[model samples]
Target: MANNPNENEQAQIIHWADMTADRIIKQKGDKGQYVLASGITPSGVVHFGNFRETITVDFVARALRARGKKVRFIFSWDDYDTFRKIPANMPKQEELKKYLFQPIVDTPDPFERDESYAAHHEKNYEAQLEKVGIEVEAIYQAKKYRKGDYKEQIKLALTKRQAIVDILNKYRAEPLEDSWMPLNIYCSKCNRDKTDHIKWDGQWEISYTCELCGHQGSENLQTTSRAKLPWRVDWPMRWVFEGVDFEPGGKDHSSDGGSYTTAQEIVKEVFGGTPPVYLQYDFVSIKGRGGKMSSSKGDLVTVNDVLNIYEPEMVRWIFASYKSNVDFAISFDLDVIKTYEDFDRQERLAYGLEEGNDKKVAMAKRVIELSQIGPMPTVCPFQPSFRHLCNVLQINDGDIKKTRVFYAKDIKNERDERRFQERSRCALHWLKNEAPDEFKFTLNRTRPALDLTKAQTDFLNNLHAFLEKEWDNLKSDKELHEKLYEVIHSVPEFEPMMGFTTLYQILISREKGPKLASFILAIGKERVLGLLRP
Candidate 1:
């Protein structure tokens, strides 16, 4: 087995999501009619980790469509599920405690913006999902349940309750009790599903007593809207009900005897439907956050926060460019600049402006294609390195126009202009919040803090004279940079770094700074000469 991807890899390396989609198409046998489904409980603030699920389905759906297979990408909000816990950020905790056992869709929105608590959260993330270019049919589980859309499925689940219990027992160490029902019934009087005791009144009505409030009521399984299947039964029921062809889940659900396993069996045996193809994706953790995120806790890096930092394309690239099962950390510090650089490098390779292996080029191209949230310019926008942009902004003291003029010599059109401005804003934010100490530097104004030797002084004077003569005809920063290298090598006593050190001491009274040539160019030739000359 080859350990490296580029080594001994074939001409075309299939992307993991594409491969999964392909298998789904072949198994389902309807290339033109396939549904890819993913859902999240709108129980709290949507976190960045939730994006893994959204983007996973989005990529696979896009890949399927790219192959001329029609796909209906559906994102379901499981809001009909009972509100089990109080979120950390929710206001009116005492007021909300009474509504805990009811469906989130029934609970009033604490913010009073939307119709219900679930609608409030769903509407927020719905806008965010649109921003990231996820074109999916957003389904609210409460509406579907209340409208009796899952009436047949609910009835079927009730009939096959014994079979579901048997299936769940296979994945559990201890057997389920004889009284365990696959469905939960809310009390008709209290509208709360946290009922401990339930009695089947044969065929249609089921009586339940709410454990939380001790409210007792009976509901007709045929006409009443007080029943919901538990997650283990509900998951597979939905898979069969919606005809889901493909879905991906986190590592925990993919573990042995996890909920997915139990659901798989229920779908196969009880629902009499083949389970959708499963892709087990890894978790995304923040650098300082100790473990995986639970959005309800409210300590999270939201998807919108990440979008504010990274371009939409680069944000999509983070997931599309990697294998699903490989765990990755999202660092907020200096690594963000490196991450942007990596994305740009891969993009260049994909566009054939840079050299890479055939398989790598193909993979890169596909990653970029899927990474886009919307159409991009035909010619890639010229971008200075993110690190360079950061330092140049600081050097210019956040004068965006001055920094842009210094960094980008040719702004082709509005697109290039817009891209440059956007990148500058992102870089400025990163520097202000997440940049590490090593990358931070301030240009010295008043000098004379250096103990320069006679030889170093002579070298600085000579380099100054050299720059005065050659700076004008020097077309670019690259040309000036090369010229600096030539001048240093001509004096065999000085090393490459020593040349930079000499320049830094004279100009900024520091040991090091930005690339000498670019820094000098950005500072303007006249300003640099004034500082360097005696």
Candidate 2:
């Protein structure tokens, strides 16, 4: 295989993120502190598509801190926004219907929790992020708005309304009407913000007639926190308020004439602030790269779902190794096992357990470095292939000790033992739920279900004797595998594959399975002898 950053190289290499951070620091002119910000609207159950933004900023923040820069990582949840549609996972859909088009903070929780609807989703979102070891200063947009933190920005946007509209119109095929206003206000009486008759009093208040409830009233700009700027304006407005040095947006927002384009223009023209350094990350899909996954469409996966089967580091590796610009999938089927195998091989090559080319090794090492959720491991732990784990787990009936002995032969240290135990738990859950039929196996407890031919019978008898004589000599799965290959190929009456198939049928009552020698070793010599003898 290819190796990265060969051991002999002396030149320093700058990672992509490091280069970007350096530029950002220079652009900001050595501000005493930099803020790395990423936010998502908690409209419903936030899915992995949402996580792309969260993890992208997280990786960049870590990269910046590694260079001795001070960074405050902030995660904002736009929970104050209205509840437009019901999420599939949330309960009380009928009860929640009444809150449609109302600010999420004003709506009651669907589950009868004391918290509002937005708070409920925020709690769930933070819990999943915790599992992945991402720590950030979580801010709720609803709370910030209600506290009147954006009052000054709201006034400025109203004053510069025409400039903001002109910038927005440049990209829109349909320009806004002359009467267009950049703000929405929650009606004082009805709580719904549906109003087209809004007129700014040119000072600290705005008059409006609620279209939904028909209550006419004026809200004080300095006192009432119900006024909110439109999304395009709000996005850039926050960029200035938070002093964000870097942030990431989804491809949908980053496209030409999209929210980002308008926001960029608004930030420069109306807000009089420079937009932050931005990275446009692509979407995640279930059908692999380029396939789109959407929360609103009910096509989604959560971080908890991914972490249920994958080790946290492996989960981080998927996002860390793949550049943010490329689309990827979080597969849950048999292919996931292959993904784990690839991660393990890359890890070995990165940590120098296996030798390879230099440049490839360096790049691989960087990936492992960034993918770490906590402190990086000092020594590479024993990595067992997910497929091998599944098979051995079946043979041992999910006994961690026997499986560890079978795979590791002996514990290398405390770290290796802990890793083995953790991996076993993840593998068992995957086998029970996600593993495909071909990967599933059940050892037969009754007599062998086979009509053995004379040649097959002869092959089995000879193999049993061969294994018994070499049992004490075989100290590892590798040695037993070589012996099994020699004996099976030596018999002309039985083809090599057919000989292995006969053993599987006798031992597992199946025509196919894991390597016969290794499976026998995991099941123990006495068990195999008793099953094969007589």
lDDT of 2 at 433: 80
Per-candidate TM-scores read 0.90, 0.93
Error in Å for residue 506 of model 2: 1.3
Give candidate 2's error at residue 117 in angstroms: 2.0
Candidate 2 lDDT over 293-363, as tens digits, reads 67766545778777778888888888987878888777777778788888998899888987877666776
Q: lDDT per residue, candidate 1, 1-534, as tens digits?
A: 124657447424788878887789788886567989999998877788888988999999988888888888888899989888888888878887888878988888899899988898888888988877888898888878777777778778778888888878888889988877777877777778878667775477677778867888877776777788898888998998889999899987988889999888899878899899888999887663356677666577787777767776777899998889888987676678779889889988878888897778888888888887767567776766787788788777877988887756667877678768878888887777777765666665555556776656666677779879878888988988988888777775778788788788776667777788878877777777777775
Which residue runs of candidate 2 sit more than 4 Å off their true CA positions? 1-13, 287-291, 405-410, 489-492
Q: Rate the local accuracy (lDDT) of all candidates.
A: 0.80, 0.81
Sliding window of 10 residues with minimal summed lDDT for model 2: 1-10
